[model samples]
Target: MHRIFEFDDIIYAVLQHVKSSGTDLVNVAMTCSRLADSALNILWAEQSSLAPLIMCLPQDTWEVTENELGHIVHFSRDPTPIEWERLRKNASRVRRLVGPHGFTDVLKLPRGESFIPDLDVSGYVLQRLFAWSRPATLFPNLCELHFDAVFSLLECSSKYWLLRKFISLGLQALRFDVIDIPTHEAEQLLATLPAEAHGLRQLTVSADDGTMALTVPPSLGKLPKLIGLAIFGIDVCLTRQTIANIQQAWCLQSLKLKLCGTSCDAGGIPLELPSLKTLHLSDGSLPQCTHFLRQVTTPKLSHIDIRYRGSASPAEMTAFIESLSTSCQTGGYLERVHVIDESKIPDPLLIIPLSSEIFRPLFKFNRLSSVKFVGVGNFNLDDGFLYDVPDAWPSIRELKLTSWKRRAIDSVTFTAMMSLASRCRSLQTLHLTVDATQSTIIPRAPDGTEKLWPTQTALRNLHLGYSQVSEVARIPYFLAEVFPTLFDFKWYDYYCGHYDDPDIAMISALSALNDALQELWALRKSAGDHDLDERWEKDSDDSWT
Candidate 1:
């Protein structure tokens, strides 16, 4: 006997199968009335643009013309006669409105002038669209709205008011690119935001031009529900009162300041953000960053990414990390740290050097899972650095130490590699430049006997730079013996050539390594060791159990 599935159950099953195919879901909706309601609901939930909905209007209400560029131009004298009932049915289902082009087609239609002139029609079209959208009935369920290009709106107050109306919809996330608002207009925009958008959780505002610095209104600090704020190409001056207002946003978790200039009053107090968890700063001056760090206290901060343009001194960078360590010592632990140098100097060695001493303070945070040190210049790591890494950061899973200068690396021997594998058993991804030019074989026991290497069951990805393939020819076999679960191995000359070049010695070593690994896997399979397959199949938590 066949059991009948409920309408909701059928829709759920069909949706699961067609989750990745929008076309299939639409077809299902068109197949029958019962499935149409549910399938259409899913199809119209996140609209990339309002063009499809606009096209649903009766053809009599709009006119289409062809331009010289062979592009279809839409001209509608009036959108008021549109079937409101049918439009509302689909519009209400929309949860996300992403306008990477800022609703150009819908907003740029020609009106009033039946004899279209050869001029810019965007202004006239936007004026009409603004009048139509001011009622707020177009998108009742929109929780997220993104505008990729908003330069047209900044020119007129009517368009700006329309923007305010959308903001008053109480959206969860609002992202817009290239907003160049005057100080007074910015104040007006900020005033309506807190009262109208109290539920806003994420806000991103960026300047239209990099050279033109947009001023951030202090009233933006009143956003009570804001948890993530990213501002780019803007100048934000923090006064004592402004800092206090920002500190009141207790729910803020992530803050990213890129190509942004932030300053405080001469006698203003420092900003304190105790609840922040992730912080990223890029393309700012050393003094600006130093002053900002000195003022802010982020006890809950766990992830930090800082990119340098060679303006920050090594001493300043060290001091900033030390300050974060001190502030988070009570109950907070840093999990990821990234330091990158963006200066693309002709001579890589001329770039600023970040010594191992600068990273010593990071050892205090024992919970670190990933640490990346990227330099266009040279990064100096002492011989004993790897020996202490396993103990200092036992939970480390991803480690990358990349530099252009190979001469900067020193004292990397085969024994050190064995020690790292043995100690950091949870390591899965590792990229390091090892000075293995002088070594030709794996390290032997003190009495010249064969040295036994510990098996690394968790390691899967390994990359070594600036190492001669002839010198470390046995590396693949050693890795296969130690890392039974290993899959990817990359060895390259950091300063010069590719590892995939036609070298007979390298090819032979790689072939022998593959044979050894396959033999080892065969032995494990015959011995009824299914644990290896299970470990590789299942996704285990980073506890390394």
Candidate 2:
């Protein structure tokens, strides 16, 4: 006789493989008592809407009528109370809850209007469901809760009560989408966070409507376990006292501010955030950023990303960069710096001066790895800046110099590239526009002996802008000598699109050189005593280029 798997085990295995819905799981549960226990757990793990579960109540407790639009469930006239014990058994298994739909627009239906008639009925059923489940804590196992279209529900006292009951469950993360809610009401909703929410690790509050402005409750700083906080499309002014509260908390590690306001008074208190590691500022005005940077000090910040609309004045830009540099030097080394300019300029060649003083403090920190200067125009660094680049940031893995003028590429450009290949061995991605013609002449020794290009074993991606066919022809040998690990090469030309197509002659030459290098490597591996020079001299006449 063959052994048989248990019924519950079979059901669990089937559930894992299939995208079984709640109704399908209910049917399986009715088939066997053992399956019922396991099926119910999987049925309520993730709930997009509570209608299906609510409809499971007895007909006398709640009646659902099917109409032309969809099924609408409402409280029955008969005084048949909800079976709280039975509902709690399944509700307790829910680990995540997505807020119901159509709470804001009455005409909008729930889940495509298939079952819910209007917002009024949806809100009525949801409120009663919460009221019944409140006795036993509806979602005892809930860890993540997302609230969408919460503005309309917050207007009703009973619905607000239901909202509070759910938030007091000590959830790990909470997200609120407050669109079109009055500022005061939004504040009230935020103030309802229970003291048990100290375990909350992530909190996000965003408003979709531009006219809506929600304030950040000072009580938020009291969440001891909170590590990530994101507030967008809301006006949150960080005053001296508020900064003090944030500093005292000392648990936050990541903060994202978008479309927010910051005010730094003349004698404002210094905002010291010692534990913050990542800060992102977007859509913030230049003056606002300057004030915030001047007041705030982050000792452990590792990443700073900024995106703004208009251009910053020279004085404002200088102050902001200096403040950021000072903070990085004191706190920890910066790993990445990204500045995106959103202003539109008519000229293609706009030079943004990145003076030595702006980058001097950065040289002291070795952890600086990825640097991107993106704008409509190019960025101009001082002369000989590239000479110290390898020494200043030896750990750099990504370097991008965009929209540079033709003058940016001169005789010194080749020397700079050689230096980067020799010194910054960790570089993996390099993006720059080079005049390949300037690199045709190979470097030679004082005695007129040709020197070999330094090998950059880590380089894998290279993007070179417009180059002549002749200029590109001379690069395959140099690339084979310098970048042994390079696999992705991109070059643009006025006539030949990209040099990546197989139909292109340049690509064929590159491939041949790559094969030759591979063959040479294989030969060295097979025979340790093989003279590489003799093999190369013999094949020099038949070289790929």
Candidate 3:
């Protein structure tokens, strides 16, 4: 035997690597006594389903049947003391029961946007098992669980209360899905979890997209130990109280709250969250964004994502931008910001009056590295405003300016873009719509014979969204001159909401432009001149010369 394998840590890590593959792990375990001892614990530590664990009991005690609902298991009678002893030994090694496999691995769930597990037998089975598991849970050492079975806790029903037994003090992470659980019971169970699962650091309770909207449980503001909270398909009941509680949860750092309507109050005392770093809000109306942001402040806020379902009016847009400056502190430490409008606001693209005035407030955030706006109205921004962007955000890494409608006229000139690469030397990605119908190339050398591109930076990816480009033959050279380091370039397609495709001819032209960009980069790499932006042009000698 190798002397290095004698160390316990080395043996454990080697076994851990092959744990994901059952066949390899089994082979390693059979090879020696030391390997087998460590493999047993890893095998029982995480389970994708309880089917295998339930089979640990005596065969005569339980039965499995296949009906329309795929698979169901039932116990003929309670397990004897000997049977319980054997199960308890195996359960001690169980640390995680909520494996990657969903209920689809156990049952034939309905087809929908999501699968909400309907555990008619799981609840009953857990009750009988715990009746014998006194002074501790069945899986006493369990540290994580995804309790998918939703059960209604009726007034007279004592059976449903056993579901709470899974929330042990040692558990640190949990993903609880509520489908048919009564609103009052769900709220009570969530609020009381701190008593049983005081060590819990993460919790997520959500329903399917079209399922019943779960209410925000009371006393969320009191969870001092909870590190993250996310709730989806929520009705936002007690909106004022919920926000107030969240404001006081100083330990909370991340939040994802999707509201059903414009339920925020017009006026309230500003809520202060001293520890919050990331916020994702999905509002029903764009105005609600202003309403919500008007009252809360995240001092340590670094990343914010806002998604609204309706069209953004100029008034609402202006108010929303103003709230950003107030919501974050004077440090201007925000790093990533994304505002997306999921509205299918149709046609007349240029009718809405939008310009640099609405988004000017964001430029004050000196630490911003990434910014994205999609489905918002098109910007009639002139090159003068965009030219100031490089100086405003010297550390900027990514910028995606998108819209849902095709541009009638591109106001942003292509002439001013090279300055971004020159000034913001760290800039890497750029997504913008510009008028590339004319070239901005100037004399490169002391004599008037050669043309030079802009300053080279770390810029690698460029996506021209909804830009007007008539001079297709001139664009590749124009882009290569400015962004000599660029490797991936796309046209018209971007992520926000969606955009009406340009005419067929325009789509073909843009696609051809992308193909040409890739080919150019490949050619540059083949010639081993990827770093030198000084050498480039359309020379017919099949060489960079």
Clashing pairs in 2: 299-331
lDDT of 2 by residue, 311-333 (tens): 55455667777777765656235
245-332: candidate 1 lDDT, tens digit per residue? 5577788898877645445445344566878898877776545555556667777888888775654566776776676676565433
Residue 72 in candidate 1 has what lDDT? 34
**Backbone clashes (count) for model 1:** 0
Candidate 2 deviant stretches above 4 angstroms: 1-90, 98-128, 149-162, 194-196, 212-215, 233-242, 261-269, 313-316, 342-357, 404-415, 440-449, 465-473, 491-545
Task: Give me the runs in candidate 3 sitting further than 4 Å from their true place.
Answer: 1-3, 55-84, 99-136, 149-160, 207-218, 233-237, 344-353, 442-457, 481-485, 493-515, 518-522, 525-545
Which digits, one per residue and each the tens of the lDDT, describe model 3 over residues 1-545? 78888888998888867776555655776898877767767777776556556667887887666556545556877788888787877678778767445322332233376533433344456566667784245678887776653222222254235557676788877776555566678778888876778887778777646556665554665565888888776554445656776665669888887766436444668788788888888855777766767778888889989988777778888999889889996547798889887765545444555788888888888888988887677777877778888878878898878765656578887666665655678888787877776665453676766656546658876777776665543666655656656665666543223367436746654665567566666666775875534443422122100
lDDT of 3: 0.68
Better TM-score candidate (1, 2): 1
Ten contiguous residues minimizing lDDT sum, candidate 2:
101-110
lDDT sort, best first: 3, 1, 2
Best by TM-score: 3
Give the runs in model 1 whose Cα sits over 4 Å from its true position. 1-14, 59-73, 76-85, 99-130, 133-135, 149-159, 212-221, 234-243, 259-270, 344-351, 408-411, 440-451, 468-473, 491-545
Query: lDDT, candidate 3, residue 297?
Result: 83
Each candidate's root-mean-square deviation in Å? 7.6, 10.1, 7.4
Computed on alpha carbons, the lDDT of every model, listed in order, comes to 0.62, 0.60, 0.68
